[model samples]
Target: MNIVLIGYRGTGKSTVGKVLASRLGRTLVSTDAEIVRRAGQTIPEIVAKLGWDYFRDLESTVCQELAMRDGLIIDTGGGAILRSQNVDSLKKTGTLFWLTASIQSIASRIGGDTQRPSLTGTKSFLEEIQEVLTERTPKYQAAADHVVSTDGQSITQIVDTIQSCL
Candidate 1:
């Protein structure tokens, strides 16, 4: 079975995923990183050059591909769960773990990241996060088989919680 990590950008999915995969002796598959590697661009670059639909299409394809693999720890992009198809595909052979954090925590963790473009084009980062997260919270909740809070938690603590859940 695969262990899939889902949440917003700053929730430690990638970091915790790396440690989880190492502890479980599984391969780590970061959908965003893979997309970047394959497309020869960062996420912001992809969104800027091709648009959000194009990026989502690419994300869907990646989700479909990764869903077929076993013994992997998949770290999904923050917006992966926005599409029901992506969520369904990832959950087919994977245990979905939604890593959650307060808006303040996320703001603090990824306040000035340039790699990811803003989903809401006209808003400030904090404003965008508040709005986007308000809409995405229910989707994330529905997608997750387990929900773990990452706020004020260390990488080791988060990994331990996920492992215990598994």
Candidate 2:
């Protein structure tokens, strides 16, 4: 089965996914990167030109494609689970781990990152994080086979926790 990591951005999904892939000798496929590749643009560019709906459609396609494979480490975009179809596709042959962190942790981790466009155009960065996390928590909770909190944990510790779960 595939090991899927889903979480808000800055929650360590990408970092943990790389280590998991290396440790397990599995291919690491990032849905966000795949979307960028398929669209021939960065995420912000895609969102700017088309909109979030278009980007999400691309994400769904990627999810469907990835789900057809096996033994992969999938690092999904933060919003991937917002659509039930994407969640369903991912869970077809994958065990999802929801990585979580406190808002403060997330803010610190991603404070300078510019690749991701603002999820809420009007809100401050912290406010956006809070609002988005509040909205997505339930979806993440429902879709997750396991929940891993990243606050105060090293990458090794987080990976060990997930490994133990598996």
Candidate 3:
């Protein structure tokens, strides 16, 4: 019952992950939270000091560890699909579900978070998010064994959709 959630940020990976985990009686693990815990810093702090490459390496390590766990729901970082190896590893380990959402949904949930390193200083923030999301389209699709759109839906509905997928 290793249900891994992969998607762009603010797509409700963490929130939906918690719901999914509860519905399925599974443990929940968030890679970003794990990275923060291990590094004793917030994601923004880690990115600022250690850099993206370094953070990605850690993300991979965390993914590897989570891959070996059982009865778990993993909420991966948005860019976790950037590395093919990470995608392969996660797919091999569990059923990967991509929580698809519009750029508007993403911006609505995360627009105010200054700690969001990805779109913090971008000139056209929504466009920037859209661009990044477009860039990852094929990769996310390739990595996911299933897909669920979260826009205009309640969390419980999203969880129900995930249950159907499983």
Candidate 4:
């Protein structure tokens, strides 16, 4: 089975995914990175040129494709769960771990990242985080096989918790 990491951008999904994949000797596949690779553009660029719908379509395709593989550490984009089909596809042969952190923790972790475009174009950074997290929390909770909190935890600690859960 694959181990899938699902969470907000700043929740350390990418970082923990790397360590988990290394520790378990599994290939690490990030859906976001895959989308960028397949589209030949960064996320912000893709979103800017094609729109969020197009970006999400690419994300869903990546999720579906990765779901067919095994023994992988699949790190998904934050909005991957917005579509039920994506969640269903990912859960087919994967155990989903939802990583969560407080808004402050998330902001501090991703304050200066420009690779991803603003999810909400109008809100302040903190407000966008709060709004997006609030909206996605239920979807994350519903799709998750296990929930891991990243607040006050190192990447190692987070990976340890995930391993213990596994």
Q: Residue 23 deviation, candidate 4, in Å?
A: 0.3
lDDT of 3 by residue, 39-142 (tens): 99888888889888889999999998888777789999999999998887787769999999988888899879776686445558888887888789999999
Q: Tens-digit lDDT track for model 2 on 18-124?
A: 99999999999999999998899999999999999999999999999999999999999999999999999999999999999999999999999999999999999
- In terms of lDDT, the best-performing candidate is 2
**Candidate 2: minimum summed lDDT over ten consecutive residues — where?**
33-42
Better of 1 and 4 by lDDT: 4
For candidate 1, the per-residue lDDT at 146 reads 99
Model 4, runs deviating above 4 Å:
none
Clashing residue pairs found in predicted model 4: none
Give the per-residue lDDT of model 4 (tens digit) for 74-125: 9999999999999999899999999999999999999999898999999999
RMSD of each: 0.8, 0.5, 1.4, 0.6
What are the clashing pairs of model 1? none
Clashes of each: 0, 0, 0, 0
lDDT of 3 at 133: 87
Q: Rank all candidate structures by their lDDT, best first, as comma-separated numbers.
A: 2, 4, 1, 3
* RMSD value for candidate 4: 0.6
* Global lDDT of model 3: 0.88
Off by over 4 Å in 3: 119-122
